[model samples]
Target: METAFADYLDEFTRRDWETLDPEAVADPVRVAVVGLGWFAREWALPGIARSAYTEATVVTDVDPDAVETVAAERDVTGVTPEEFRSGAAADAYDAAYVATPNAAHLDYVRAAAAQGKAVLCEKPLEATLDRARRLVAACRDADVRLMVGYRMQTDPAVRRLRDLLRAGVAGDVVHVHATMSQTMLGELGGDTDQWRLDPELSGGCALMDLGVYPLNTTRFVLDEDPVRVSGRTRTRHEAFADVDEHASFRLAFPDGVDALCTVSQNAQHASRLEVTGTEARLISDPAFYEREDRGFAVVRDGTRVDVDFDQVHQIEEEFAYFGHQLLADEPFHPDGEHALADMRALDGIYRSAETGRSVTLDEDAA
Candidate 1:
């Protein structure tokens, strides 16, 4: 297992982060990762391992077999869910990473925050807006930092796009079209025990599972909130009888910027983000995912300019930023308020989809 982890470490090169002083990275923030699922194992673990300012000291999960498997590969203490909720476990770490199922997020977060530990929660905040608000308040009352894991918000390509828009390379941004889809049914066929398929566990369906990407990414890039939303959804397969298989929605921002976004569980794998303005347009062919290499292009005045970035890891930057917030007293980006805003927008979207009418959102809902 150690040999395998060493090989995994070799697959990626070390990154130089501008946010922290390489020589000054000491007393790494100890983190307890609650949930040993696919995302936690595949992405979050590797990302946290590469950081100089953070250490994953403890891991928790309900399945003892899964916990044993992960514990063998990593040098971290593995505890069952019951032990993790106890007071002794809370005192063992400075922060907790909540990567449990969607429905379990709030409970894990509150447990960690109750221990006076900072929390890095996986996206969506909660299954519903009302619950999400309560979760945020709990963390605030505990006086702990709460950051949502919107990995792409720290992506180089996404940040470059934002910079171009700020530089007026796209003039006044007018429209955005974003799409993200994956064949979940084909990928995990007949896996009824999969928590994501259960509406109670996953909150909604495709929108809650996949739609949050385009929805949150657009808002991140634009740095603006929408005033209204209209949405429609459908469940195309019996396997997804309890949840949506596809969803489409449009958001109207205050400054006349309109965003059309779609998510699906029954489509060819695709992820793209395009923004149009009066002067030019910017496009990210394979946008919003953590990858070694991705391209961003700009089309202006009948000429195209392309920029290709070297190997970059979104998860690495995410944990590094969390470390920055913990160690350097830096304000956390995409904080709880950010997730709450997205939740509010999604709440309006689901309502609009159910009633077949546009839903208006209050700008000052916090």
Candidate 2:
């Protein structure tokens, strides 16, 4: 007895199952999550656990107690950083998620890659362009995947915006303006001695922490790299020591499209982005990276259209996407090359700040 539902299932199986072998199922990719801090436990590990293609096999942290607490809470086992250094913990996983502090990302990523493990590292790949380039080259030499946490790349709204721009819905992009700022409340506030407040450790001030959002977003949406950058920074608060608490930058793309970005640690909560083109404009409220109650409004010829999006857990989506790529042997986008580009841009920003002039990217430098 032939049935309509049977045919539907058969069609799906025929098209999608061509590359899948029923008898050759592979084991889930084993993942070791580094750092048991706020982000790792509450977000990354949980997200990895929720992913269908990867298993959270282990966790590691420098603080033994913190690691043990998270392992108990998440029902997963972990090793202390000392144990990991001894190579006892390194053999237990096939991949790692490096969620350590900004300063620690380089060393941790190197160690994981040396151990023949694919690495998913948190953003700002490293504190400097030199370090970022070295890490990318090292990963390439090791023949392992190195992915940076540009999680906004997986946001549906961001994806849609990229699609619109690529599809020429907005015509030629002429300008981009983005802002990501919030009061440095609670732990986000530097206590005169916090690592993030230290220029040496944090790489920069609010720009490195929050400003990366706009920088990365503009690049992603425009699908172009900045050829020149000019910027100014000011230390509004004494808490940041030598680091600037507020800063702004103007990035000029190859086609004369300019991107204006601002980031601060002392402003009231506000994150907004707008892309103005020859035909229309796309504006997003709140953070482009956040998955809270947010939407994008398009304006053209005095007509406005607002599109609401479902709340999505970006961490979950990011982890799931990484896991799926691993399982399917697909290449991961925004890999080390992407991180190197952002770091290069950041290098330009710092140069602009130091000299108070626009700095151009040296293509060969990256």
Candidate 3:
């Protein structure tokens, strides 16, 4: 058996990925995609389409026309939400990818788990902390693997950053600063029915959507949970009156390690994660994109070492890891517990922002 990290050995500068061979597992996983929306249609499907370790067996959506459109292009069976919940569909796939909205993740995940299919869900796990915990419990009780769709966990550059931190190359982590910003309506060109503005559907605003990148990245790099959080959220424009347009939060982890993160729906353009330690600093600009290539840098004692990574399709990496977990019974890196921890911290952040006070967290609660 090959080591799990063998493929990533030359990921930093590898440009010949087209010639790279596919994985040799016992059986490729058959995945039923539960949503046919923008993210599922664009980013996720392309990766799943490429991976030899996974196949999109069926597509599910409330809108049959949308499902049929995606099905025709992807060459997968299209099913309505009702048929997807039936027993016949349950037995068709080894795993289900929950690409639905943040708020609806719980029901879909629970249903998939109950049918004894492994689940890979998009970030946040659920819209809120309570549901997140329940989803985790449901999966656990069903004895099925539950993984969060966190591409950064498998991203080459991000993995290099984590490796450096773990190897103490940065020397005693002290602080981290991250930012992810985008003009949602501008980029999406969608109307208000986008479901992101509704508190009941999307949960929170920028923090719940784009903020997860920084939130999950900081935690992944540090490998530590936050003990306290303080945040502030605002509705910068009348268009965002029902939800927050901007949010900034501070996290206090054990050993005095602190992190600052900002997420915004009204910003020009910003995506970065910077880690500063006693000895050096590591930075990743455009930290959370699905592009095929990106660059990062390491700075120490006035010397800079820039590293450029090629073939950065994190979604493929995510699917590969999920397939490994299914075939080898390997642990999912950012497992359900990993997501629940982040949801708990986000819950604290939202409460702190609303009350204008620091929210302390108990390690035992999560």
Candidate 4:
């Protein structure tokens, strides 16, 4: 009998890369996480440390106290931003997780690539497509593997949906509707200096923060690039004056399939995806970033087929997958090309929102 990890490895190999034994690698990958914020401290650091093929060696942040506290809590060493800038601090780790703000992703990624270390960057890749392309090229030139932190790709429920879609269990996908919204983030406005509300850091509000989930998930599940896009966006809160607080978009695939997605910072709660097909419809509950009891239902002929998944920490799954890839010498999932495509889609969304016209990807762009 094969374990879930073995099945995951096999699936990744069958879909994306060649096979390799995850157990054969000699050294545990030493990793440093470059942010001591909520995400790094609460999720990523612990997950990586718990992974079998990786060890959390160091943490860095501009706030010394924050870094020190996370390090003390996680039992890892700490490095100041000044030490990181001097290039003396990052040498101890074989790789780095750039969990910084959206705009800073490229710079941190480039720094790690320059040091010939693999990098796992938090999403949005960069605030712009040009920067993302450059980062991808730099990583390739430096022979460093780069992966985006699109943890949904490693999620078991999402994986199951992908399988169903690919296997034609949801036959001939015609339309997809995805919604992601939350009031929690907007209410917890702490520092006006926090990067998320700043256009220079968070990129473009709800779209960059939450829209990326549906956009990425739609592309992943359908295995198709959007051919054209049109969008409408608004900034509802004064705190996000520099960025949008709500956004909705329509995407058309080459095969006539359409996707309608909405993201908002002021909504009451979260919603998920509804995938409609010729034969059946599939519905996912609170689809994005679900950590516990995450599951889906398949509806065919007005009957519901229920599916249940064990409650697993998505961050843990993500770290474990990354570890397995590194140890097995397997190709990184959500590699540079995937990141580039996602950026292209996002660029289209922004353009469409501003121009109030449909934006189409050039053949070369895809």
TM-score for candidate 1, residues paired by index: 0.92
| Cα lDDT tens digits for candidate 1, 139-165 | 999998999999887776777677667
- lDDT score at residue 293, model 4, on the 0-100 scale: 54
Clashes of 1: 0
Q: How accurate is candidate 4 locally (lDDT)?
A: 0.79
Q: Write the per-residue lDDT of candidate 4 for residues 12-95, one digit (tens) a residue.
A: 323232244446645778888998788787688778866666788888988889988888987877888666646676668888
Q: What lDDT is reached at residue 78 by model 1?
A: 85
Q: lDDT tens string, model 3, 140-216? A: 99999999998887777777787777777788998999998888778777466777898887888899998888989
lDDT of 2 by residue, 1-366 (tens): 113212322322121212434235357678888877777877787777775666788888888898888778777767877666466777678888988777788777877887888989888887777877778887888789988888888766676677677766677888999998777754443446666777777788788888788998899988888889889888856776678789899999987899999998888777888999998887877654343555677787788877654656778768767776777787788799987778888888888999988998876775
Candidate 3, residue 261: lDDT: 91
TM-score of 3: 0.93
Off by over 4 Å in 1: 1-17, 188-190, 363-366
By TM-score, the candidates rank as 3, 1, 4, 2
lDDT of each: 0.82, 0.77, 0.82, 0.79
Lowest summed lDDT window (length 10), candidate 3: 1-10
lDDT of 4 at 143: 93
